[model samples]
Target: AQSVTQLDSHVSVSEGTPVLLRCNYSSSYSPSLFWYVQHPNKGLQLLLKYTSAATLVKGINGFEAEFKKSETSFHLTKPSAHMSDAAEYFCVVSRNTDKLIFGTGTRLQVFP
Candidate 1:
């Protein structure tokens, strides 16, 4: 069984500020976790991923996340927020069969 939970449905931040989004996951098999960002009406893009090989995963657009097995969490964080960063983010988990299950969604609001 593989499941992901995005703790917040929406997060608002000021432009040029830092951004943080929380995610927790549970997996019965060895887990492969990922964070994906999607602009409005756009396809999902890979932000970062954590395979068994790496715990700290760095992703595109200055975003990063750490996989914690004990806590069953993989939270995304960034030191700065660009106006372009305002979008929907999804936390995903891969089952052993190679299929991905996505979280509901997280809407990021950036105020100028």
Candidate 2:
């Protein structure tokens, strides 16, 4: 079985500062990791994904995540934050199947 834990339930950042959302994963085998973002009244969007190809994966809106097998981490990061970036983020794990295990989610609050 595979599972993911989001270290932080909430994250805050200034409009121009960096953003980091921590996530740790556990899987029996090589798993596909993903970061999804959801804005107010909107559906979840694919931010980025890691499928055993590259360690560093880039996503939409300046977001990226690095897959670190040694650390068992796939933390999401952005160089700068935006007001529109305020939303809920999810860390997910999949075993090349249709089933997706989601984290509790982290709410990102961007301030001016």
Candidate 3:
């Protein structure tokens, strides 16, 4: 079985400051990890994904995440945050055709 834990339930950042959302995952086999964001009244958007290929995966909106097998971590990071970046973030994991496992989610609050 695979599962993900979002270390922080909420993260607050000032506009233009860096943003970091921590996530830890457990999987029986190689996992495919993903980060998705959802703004108020909006559908979920794919932020980034990590397959078996590259450890460091980049995605839309200047967001990226690195897969660290050694640490069992796949943390999301952005150099700077925008007011529009405020949303709920989810960490998902899947393994070999299995159903996606989602984290509890982290709410990001960006203040201007």
Candidate 4:
């Protein structure tokens, strides 16, 4: 079984500042991790993914995450925040199957 936790339910950042969204996971086997974003009333879009290849993985929109096996963490980050970056982010995990375990979600708010 695989599960994920997003530490924060909401994250606020000023425009142009760095952004961070923390996530932790647990799986019986080595799992595939992913970060996804969803705008209001829109379908989810993949931000980045990790599949036991590289520890550091880059995603769209300047976002990246490092897969830490020992710590069981995969935190999402972006160099600079933009107003358009504000959205609901989800941390997902799965082992072999298409079914994904999704976190509650973290809502990012960007302020000028």
Candidate 5:
């Protein structure tokens, strides 16, 4: 069974510190992993994806993740948090179609 597990359901960060959203996954194949951000009243936008390639992958808006096969994890990280970063984030495991098995989103609340 291929699925993603987000360690936290919610994260609060001040508008300047770093952001870390932990995610762990289980898969039968060397699956594809994705992090998507959903702002208020908006659909999900891809932040990053690991397709069994690089160990460390970078994506939009100063975000990145390192695929650790041994750990069965791909955790999202950022150097700085922003007010606009307040949103719901989903860790995804996908094979075909954009149809991803999404983790119960981690709601990020940014404090000013």
Candidate 6:
């Protein structure tokens, strides 16, 4: 079975500063990882994904994550933060032919 754990349940960041959301995973086979963001009472938007591709994967809106096989980690990072970026983030993991396993979710609160 494949599973994903988001280490932080809530993260607060100041506007214009960097943002980091930690995530870890466990999988029986090679996995495909993804990051998705959700706004208040809205659907999820796919931020980025790693599918046996590059370890350092870049996403939209200046967000990026590095997949580290040795550490079993896929940590999301952003060079700068914006108020609009304040949303719930989820770390997902799955196999090519398997269903997705979603993390508990990390809520980001951005302050001016």
**Predictions in order: lDDT:** 0.93, 0.97, 0.95, 0.96, 0.94, 0.96
Candidate 5 lDDT over 21-62, as tens digits, reads: 999999988889999999999998999999978889999999
Model 2 per-residue lDDT at 65: 99
lDDT of 6 by residue, 68-101 (tens): 9999999999999999999999999988867888
lDDT of 2 by residue, 1-111 (tens): 889999999999999999999999999899999999999899999999999998999999999999999999999999999999999999999988769999999999999
Count steric clashes of candidate 4. 0
- Between prediction 1 and prediction 6, which has the larger lDDT? 6
Worst 10 residues of 2 by lDDT: 94-103
The runs of at least 3 residues in candidate 2 whose Cα sits more than 4 Å from the true structure, single-residue gaps closed, are none
Runs in model 4 deviating more than 4 A are none
Q: Candidate 4 on 3-90: residue-level lDDT in tens?
A: 9999999999999999999999999889999999999999999999999998999999899999999999999999999999999999
Q: Residue 7 in candidate 1 has what lDDT?
A: 99
lDDT of 1 by residue, 1-112 (tens): 7899999999999988889899999888778999999999999999998888778889999999998889999999999999999999999999556989999989999999
TM-score of each: 0.95, 0.98, 0.97, 0.97, 0.95, 0.98
Name the better of 1 and 2 by lDDT.
Answer: 2
TM-score of 2: 0.98
Give the Cα error of residue 51 in candidate 2, in Å: 0.3
Clashing pairs in 2: none
Candidate 5 local distance difference test against the native: 0.94
Error of 6 at 76 (Å): 0.5
Question: CA lDDT of 17 in candidate 6?
Answer: 97
What's the lDDT for residue 95 in model 4? 79
Q: Going through the candidates in order, what is the number of backbone clashes in each?
A: 0, 0, 0, 0, 0, 0
Question: On a 0 to 1 TM-score scale, where does candidate 5 land against the true structure?
Answer: 0.95
